[model samples]
Target: MVAADGGTDRASALVTSAKFSEAAQRHNFEAGWLVRDPWRASTVSDHFRRLVANRLFVAL
Candidate 1:
């Protein structure tokens, strides 16, 4: 259940629904935080670029 009082409902839903895979859960949780975190949004561009680069290298 979500900490509806002052917490993230969507994240709660994702958890309750068991949508998070074991290896990916931490990443998913962090992603949820990023979406809700304004500070994270401001700096995520660089992180996204690096992530894309890593993925591209893997794909190659």
Candidate 2:
């Protein structure tokens, strides 16, 4: 979950969901979802590098 200033909030929510739900935990880990704020260049750059290195596609 990536948003301008709400990335942490969104990620936290997902984490909470996974914490309580077995299906959510499996899907979350399998999907490898992460939170990144575009304003944070370093984090975004790191995510981009990982994606490229893994040959992964961004859903959005």
Candidate 3:
């Protein structure tokens, strides 16, 4: 079973409270490309850019 908001703690809390089991389960997290507000694109892009900027870059 896959939950859309599974990435959030609230979803996990609800699932646990419902007695849903994840034991021996293969997990996958996908950022669904279904943002309602179109303006979220710029916001998400900027956030990603900032995150990458803060990371140390190494050249091999």
Candidate 4:
């Protein structure tokens, strides 16, 4: 019993997929992926770079 889902249009698919995965007795879980838009990329990258540098080399 294996189940996988990604992107939209997941619900209509779940109805048929649920049967193969033992939907009645199985546990459910929720997970999400991190995404950044082009506009935010530079800012996020700069912040991340500084954060890593600070962690690696502590300032006096």
Give the winner by TM-score.
3
Q: For model 4, name the residue pairs that clash.
A: none
Residue 5 miss distance in model 2 (angstroms): 22
Q: Give all TM-scores, in the order shown.
A: 0.25, 0.29, 0.35, 0.31
Clashes of each: 0, 0, 0, 0
Look at candidate 1 and give me any clashing residue pairs: none
- The lDDT values for all models are 0.38, 0.46, 0.37, 0.38
Among these predicted structures, which one has the highest lDDT? 2
Using lDDT as the measure, name the better of candidate 1 and candidate 3. 1
Pairs clashing within candidate 2: none
Q: What digit string (tens of lDDT, one per residue) describes model 4 on residues 2-60?
A: 11232223311111223335564377443433333333444444554576688963434
Question: How much lDDT does candidate 1 score?
Answer: 0.38
Candidate 1 lDDT by residue in tens digits, 1-60: 222212333321111333557766755543333243434443443454566688852322
Q: Tens-digit lDDT track for model 2 on 18-43?
A: 34477766666544344443345346
For model 4, the local distance difference test gives 0.38
Per-residue lDDT, model 1, residue 56, is: 50
